[model samples]
Target: RRDTGVWDGRLGWGRLTHGRAADVLKNPAYAGAYAFGRAASSRKVRPDGTVVACVNRRPRDQWTVLIPDHHEGYVSWQQYLQIEAKLAANRTSTGARPPREGPPLCQGVIYCGSCGFPMSTGYRRADGTADYVCNRARSDAVTTPGCHSIAAAAVDAQVTRLLLAALTPEQVHLALAAADDLHHRHHRSHRGAELAVERARYEADRAERTFTQVEPENRLVARSLERRWEEKLAALAQAEAALADLAAARPVLPEPDRLHALAQDLPRLWDAPTTGAKDRKRLLRTLIADVTVRHVDHSRAHIGIRWHTGATDEVVCDRRTNRNPTQAVELVRSLLDTRSDAEIAGHLNALGLRTGKCRPFTVASIRHIRQQHAIGSKRNDPTGPGEITVPQAARILGVHEAAIYPWLRNGEMPARQDRHRRWCITWNPQTEDYWHNRVATSSHLKRTNPNYETGQAV
Candidate 1:
């Protein structure tokens, strides 16, 4: 619709400007109500002999010809008003407000329970992965923000499933009704355009007559009339061109059977990829007035949907994992020096903390968590990166720490002591290979037994 008839420049009809389109959409007449004296223009004379005019819209109560039920319209007056409010809410300039345009079904609807600010939408690296993030935890002094996010796919799926379950044929029927209205709307538009052309032609003719009838010596009045005539002709040409285009592009009315079939498959059509995000949102707004979401925890969100008819629906959608790594980092860093991996995991579970997959923490999970956050562990030597404690090395080597002590005293073992006097050894591939070779040659075995059994040295 942006470039409706741009096939060839000569015969093409350009689309309306953004401001003009918005004005047309916002007009109350489109909703069937007719009114007069809706706007007033005030002209101010400038110092340089130029006139400045400003138009101000008057309130509906001030209108002289206000009528509630003027004629049949595409939408009811109440619905038209709701659409206007929704449009205002959808504007990004309306900060921390609802009714935004986005793929995240709950983007504008969900407010942070903690700070009462509207959640914002973000996208993951992958396509179709949206995140509804609450950024209220942010502060000027603190570099780390307490903002939280939820995956959009799960939330959207839950909403869609719930919505489809609650919906009846009424929504589909309304859409069908709109389609029927559009077909009839063309007839009304054709008539209006024809009348406009007629009016413009008359004005053009009248101006031309006035210009011709003017005295030849009165050049000022003649020039003014000539300019008015030119303007009227231009208006007439525009109206005629629109009328021609409308006549040419008017669609043949679809058969009743096709409409019936389409209505029957309306649900399937709604689920189809052909239905765009904007249309889906519009359809949702028709039934759902507002949806409020509260983040109860990492995995769970309590959602409340308010329907226009004073009814409400509530449900909880839980994710399997927590995506925010900030919480895990802080928790693990505090517990690293005091607890073993298993003990730390137990503590995490006791605190009701879960991983990104929403699973209970395990020893390996704890180790991985510590590794990710650079937390020092018994298995992780603090001297250099990838260093292990003597006990850890002994376990890896399939021997006792006492065996490592003897080697350390004999100057055969390479190790370092930390501030706590705990021996640290680097366990690499070479370490394991050396242990395997020593075991193969029996160099690391205790000397005994053979002489005692044979009663002689062999």
Candidate 2:
């Protein structure tokens, strides 16, 4: 019963609904504190000339009156504060993110060192590896270059090593002490539930005794007393059931010797198949307050670990190899000057070379790599030393580019198509004369003059 001997509009002795339970938890009065003006009411005029009243709950700082230790409480003030903190942390929006299920070790606790904001976890579809990216600029729609991103693997490995190192023998001893405290707390809570059950049983027995003592001839009094006894018996059963559940939910604590052995082999336990990502994250968050990471360069990243003990540690870890290997990029750059995108892709695939994402090279992928690295495509550049386009070949042979295409198609002229399927012919003084003679001797040939360099009009 939540009765306070006041005229509050509550039955104070019924099955509690979820909303009522939440209200009870949020009220500071239950924690031996007096709070006033926790909520504010306002009246607003609608467009239809109707007044609508609204009630908004205020923040703790905005409350009008608050007095600690105002009266006896169901829970201590410290427990109430802890409960509030936990509720705030569980909220996803505008609150600290709780540990979630994912492969990223520092998902919720990671921050961007550059912008000093929480980083978001993202996964690369190509390789399925995770990344921690500082998305402050993007999320806020600011006109600034976005902050850096670091691969999760390197940062996670470094933090894991640090965590294992911090778990020294002395630290294990302290952990055992914490475990002991937790066991005692659980025992005390269970005992409290048992005592409540005993009190409920006594209440039921007293109600039964009163019902038996009522006169059988007094029908009204006898019926009322019997009904009261039934209610008390029901309450006793509910209390006993609750106590049983509490006992069943209690965790079994390990012996000190076993805990020490497990602590010694902590690394193996962490990597065990039974361990899950969520479990690892929870364990990590217990010791680490937060981790800030920034990419120093392509090959290294700086990591800062802030522990729960107010101590901080910094480490530099080598970043994972770039998706596109240095050797692969160099090879692509070298081939871009001479080969078409298709030809380069083919050569790369033939040499057992894959892109940074470990996928076989494709024409589109090659083009993307070229554009990303600012390497010009062969088709975009003018003819190089021994190469000429169809237009150039046609100009030298005194024919239209369309006419040159026929010879190329018929294999009468040696040429190759670039990535876009445009013909490229080898051009030189000798090759030019050779094509001119071939054109002049062909029955399908036409010229402005029989003799070359006559400069005559058509």
lDDT score for candidate 1 against the true structure: 0.72
> Model 1: per-residue lDDT, tens digit, 155-266?
7777777677655456556655776898799989999999999999999999889999999999999999899999999999999999998997787766666756765676
Which structure among the candidates has the greatest lDDT?
A: 2
Reference-based TM-score, model 2: 0.48
TM-score of each: 0.39, 0.48
- lDDT (10s digit) by residue, model 2, range 365-400: 887887878876555745566988875565567765
RMSD of 1: 18.6
RMSD of each: 18.6, 15.3
After superposing candidate 2 on the true structure, give the runs of residues whose Cα lies further than 4 Å from its correct spot: 1-51, 56-86, 125-127, 143-146, 168-255, 318-430, 434-458
